[model samples]
Target: KESLDVIKVLTSKVRWITLLQRLTLKQLWVARNVSRVSIAIWKEKSQAVHQYCARWIYNSSIAFNAIDNDDFRLFCEALGQFGPGWQPPSQYQLREPLLNEEKKRTKEKLKHLEEEWETDGCSVMTDACTDMKRRSIMNLCVNSRGGTCFLGSKDSSKDSHTGEYIFEYIDKCIEEAGPLKVVQVVTDNATNNVAAAKLLKMKRPNIFWSGCAAHTVDLMLEGISKLPGIAKLIDQAKCLTIFIYAHHKTLDLMRSHTQKRDIVRPGATRFATCFLTLHSLYEKKALLKNMFGSDDWHECVHSKSVKGKASYETVMNIGFWSSMTLVLKIFSPLVKVLRLADGEKIPSLGFIYGEILVAKNSIKEATYQMERNYEPIIKIIDEKMKGRLDAP
Candidate 1:
């Protein structure tokens, strides 16, 4: 009878504790929901007011004490889930005036962007679609003279041909954006893009048509890679990069084991393999050499050996590095042009014109040098080919 009474008492106590836990959990959920609704209501009323009230509520000693004393410990625990980086408003008093100032600044920026679009020498157009099948074309204008550039977009019908649709969209843009004395339109060599360029040239005869240098470079790079071994070598380099980057703990260990070189950051998968290879050579040469001499490297290289040898020779050549250095040196003047254009205190047109003249001279000099370098190589190849044909 005594043992039965003791068991009954223990069971009853366990039930009470379980019920208490359940009630606490329910209260916490309800509190969180209430807090969320209150925040929503406050936001609807005014962001400034809501921010101010939140600041006060978070900082008040009395509120903290009340929370500490109550069965609302679960609610307090829920509140603690807010991120440590959260910060309340520093100056709530200037809220209205700040908002007004921002609005005025936005209007000024739009006005400036529009003025730039009207006078810009170069522009680009591209299109993208949403999940809802709503199609839109984006037009971006860049003034070589320097100022706020314009970006505008418009929607098109779902069934509309992308090329004709984009052309119509461009026409609408020109009408809305005002007279654009553009000197060039740069785009990818897409059929639609080509048609648009032709149409634009017909509409504005004075405007020169040119393909994007970046796009041209991409195409050239792609063509070069397709030459047997180059693409495979590039792929092997990419795989090596993946091996190094994918395992963070291993990468960290490698860094510690090596000369404490800067570890690659998280989410940097798109980093160029060339740079990564150079870094490995400079910082972790021993580890890289070991890995390169392993079975994995042999397999990757052997799979594309015929092309790999030529690709490796091309990449490792001193001439390739010289060419890269020369290109960088040639484009160095554009950095100054970009800096001058981005100045907040707008410089006079004469100052801008002077800079443009300087840039034009630099470009002319660079082009001359490039032509000079390639002329000898071109002449030799041509002469050799002609001699062979004549002999035959």
Candidate 2:
């Protein structure tokens, strides 16, 4: 190692500035030539290659929200480190010239998709979201046997998202995507969105408007969570969560009992979080029983407080555990359907309607003869699905 270090020092002492400069220039020349030749080859290979590459970067930017000018430069610079033959596209090269090029390619592709869909038909799914600046944006995406593609987006903050306004937005998407090509439109179960769907159907009777299956199941969960019996249990569960998590010592004791798992897991939706919170509590039932009986719990001063005592007693109550079971029995199916609907691997259209039926039947069989218990839950799901046109 010492001899190698000495050899390295001796080699470092040599003046290779001119050689290094020549190598750098050669690399630059090679990179420029490769980039130019690559473009020429891309042109010869057909526009599909260009479109495929552009869609990859564009979709990645939208999916991860990480493609900025600086990020692009860093990505290209990192790639440049490998070899001069592998030149990277500049941000401007992508954002401006390549962007326009891709747009043209996309239009051509959209035209082709529209032509193909003329016979088979496609579905457009519309959703509204607010960006970081609190600006409402309307986005439209289309799916068919051919493939799925984003149609367009518009800033809708200024406009009232009335049925007519949304209908117009849908119309514009249809016009761009080819009106005759779209056979169905799907949106959330919001009243205005429902109205918009109805209006679009009136205009384009041949096209169906279906309510989003994911949103429908979420609403079902929301309704079920609000039932008086379930609501009380949820409140107790939340109180227990707050009491334990609010105090570090109690939280640590909880971790010790449950092998460091919180009694509440974060969820993407409100009802989802509510059910998951209850589910977590149910999972930690034994740990919680042990916790209330533990020496540390008895010694803790907060344990004597009204909130803490109430929470501890709730955990000890058999009725609370029973109520949790009922909650899970009624709502777990909705969670299942939610997962099935939100899945990406397979198309959901084939299974969602059938799953809704199975979910209803499972709950019915679980709570049979307890008509009072199951009636409201079944009613909510039925009413949500009624006339919503979810069938493929």
Candidate 3:
């Protein structure tokens, strides 16, 4: 030991590392072996911990990002302090063998659905979208009592989407799925799609042709949006949202006034969004009026701006609020119908037609049994419904 201390002073690294030959050298070699054995044990234990944690996460079906949560991190830290350190599955395991196992299980579960498709029949629903590649892609799915299964997608970038083209494509899909297994085909209410439905009616008479209920209701809202009064109301409402949100300070003030609830309510469709925003404005009428009339608003630079002055008058406009209430009376129930048709939960098919009727009654009642107020709105609704949703 004394020799090693003297050697330490002689070394450039300022520490004595080498074991002098004989008695001390054997002790050094035994210490190295113990260190190596401890590391090996820890590595094996860590791998086992990772495997266990990965299986638990998979079985529990928690979100993948749950591990990033503050609560979950604290929970993990507590375990590491008192229980055991855990590891997750490797990327390879998640992507390869585990993925294959999930696929096999999904297919096995889908077999019973295939049997139901043959017996109860399914709806062949199609929707089109533009993918990131700038190609128009059409997706096909089969919806039955069991569940909805995605059949596949096709890039139709080169194909024309004419009535005849759509009919032929849908007919082929039906044929491939077994024509008897398809009870109906549902698509958007585009002119080409309507034409395609007619062609399908002529050829496959047993298979019903149903317009996409949600799209149909959206078109109804689309028509109502073009009405002179509703159009002006929406324009003003949009301007109001734009003015408040464009300035962060004003937005913060507005949030303080409204208890953090935003005045903008976006719906599933743009047309729906207009009505929803109007509904939001109506609901926050008191808050907005209070905001515009506040001392803070008077002190702010925006309060004196042309836009701000206009916004104040707009908020205080009695006729504007009246029109908004009237519009919502007629359209709010329809928005509910649109949501019902758009949602997947609770099998909305049976409820939609009944709800549409309910919405009509609601509009009528909203007008206080006076035909004059509701008549024009009903006329627009009837026009959109006539040959499409209303037709036998």
**What local distance difference test score does each model get?**
0.50, 0.83, 0.86
Error of 1 at 160 (Å): 7.2
Q: Residue 110's C-alpha lDDT in candidate 1?
A: 68
Please tell me which model should have the higher TM-score, number 1 or number 2.
2
| Poorly placed runs, candidate 1 (over 4 Å) | 1-139, 142-146, 155-161, 188-191, 244-253, 260-283, 290-392
Task: Note the residue pairs that clash in candidate 2.
Answer: none
| Residue 254 miss distance in model 2 (angstroms) | 1.7
Residue 41 lDDT in model 3?
100
Residues 305-369, model 2: lDDT tens digits: 99888988898999999978978888888888888777776445657888888888889877864
Provide TM-scores for the models: 0.42, 0.75, 0.73
Worst 10 residues of 3 by lDDT: 12-21
User: How well does candidate 1 match the true structure in TM-score terms?
Assistant: 0.42
- For 1-392, candidate 3 gives per-residue lDDT tens digits of 99998777788343334534554879889999999999999999989978988899999997889868897789778778875455667999999998999899889977888899889999999888998989999888888998888888888999999999889889988997889899989888999998999999999999988787888889888887777877898888888899999998799989999999998887789878888788888999999999999999998889889999989899999998998998888788999998888886633555677788899899899889898767777788787676567643
In model 1, what lDDT does residue 283 have? 48
Model 1, span 301-361: residue lDDT tens = 3325544444344434555444434343333343344345344554543454456446546
Clashes of each: 2, 0, 1
Which candidate number has the best TM-score? 2
Ranking by lDDT: 3, 2, 1
Backbone clashes (count) for model 1: 2
Off by over 4 Å in 2: 1-87, 90-101, 346-350, 389-392
Model 1 lDDT, residue 126, Cα:
46
